[model samples]
Target: MNRNLAYALVVFAATAAAAGQAFAETPTLETTPFVSVKTRADVQAELAQHKANGVNTYSIQYNPLKSFKSTAQREQVVAEYIASRDVVAATTGEDSGSAYFAQARTPHSVSRTLAGTPVNTAR
Candidate 1:
């Protein structure tokens, strides 16, 4: 009985340690950016460029989740939050995906989808 209890505790302790590490490694408020910019572009441009380069696809990725405070300065915080995401997408060339965010002091959360297209200038 003592050995069994000890083994169980060891397993639990290991799991707890792992979970704590993950949380600690997660991005902090200061590390995460608060401004972003993106371009509405020709998606096919990537496809064509990749093909010409003998590749099947070109892709970019960014963290889709963002956090903000909904305190008295909700609008300011939210604006910065959204801008930060735009910058990520533009910098990485990530063109698709949505945002899932939560306020710092409330249960309020939001999800928003972004779409874009490049204007044809050759005409």
Candidate 2:
């Protein structure tokens, strides 16, 4: 019984040592050197410059007929669409020497059918 207890203690000690080593090796959250953290004032100044350069902010309109699997997916798609539109709008505004305001409307959704029956799922 003493021998068995000693062996069990040895195994437990080795396991704990390994676990501690692994835990020490685990990466901690560290700020990346390449990433620059901008302050609120800096952000406001950048936005002001963008606006002064004739970049007008606009709303993104999603198609009512389109079906999104989830709100997050819809938001991601809309964000990407808006980013592209902003680039175009900024260029246009700069060329015209005036701020251009416009709403981006998503294209109509593809027609979905089930068992030869057309489904109108518009939310």
Candidate 3:
């Protein structure tokens, strides 16, 4: 009787596992293959435009820094960085600034519960 009971339990477990797997929803994939809207000439024209713009992306000696120039003055950039230094440090801290932001008095930090009671002055 004990052996028979163990066999029944094993059969039940196998059936339950198989049913779980068989009833699982499968992702449906698109049947149609992809088709390109642009012709070979369109691609060639785009490459030509990039070359005209002095951007040689395919070249091994490509350097974006060669043409880069900052619009902001050095003093202005340094001042802006100094102002945001504390905020940046807090955000990148161990707790990811959750504690700092929670205590922050910014407009976005105002909780919905603290929005104050609505007043009706309709006469």
Please report the candidate that would top TM-score against the real structure.
Answer: 3
Structure candidate 3, residue pairs in collision: none
Which residue pairs in model 2 clash with each other?
none
Q: Which runs in model 2 stand beyond 4 Å of their true positions?
A: 21-123
C-alpha lDDT of residue 29 in model 1:
65
Q: For this target, which candidate reaches the highest lDDT against the unseen true structure?
A: 3
lDDT of the structure predicted as candidate 2: 0.68
Q: Which runs in model 1 stand beyond 4 Å of their true positions?
A: 21-123
lDDT comparison, 1 vs 2, better candidate: 2
List, in order, the clash count of every candidate structure. Answer: 7, 0, 0
Work out how many backbone clashes candidate 2 has.
0
Model 1 poorest ten-residue lDDT run? 96-105
lDDT of 1 by residue, 19-87 (tens): 863345756568676553433355667667767865332344332333454456878988888989865
Model 2 / residue 5 / CA error / Å: 0.1
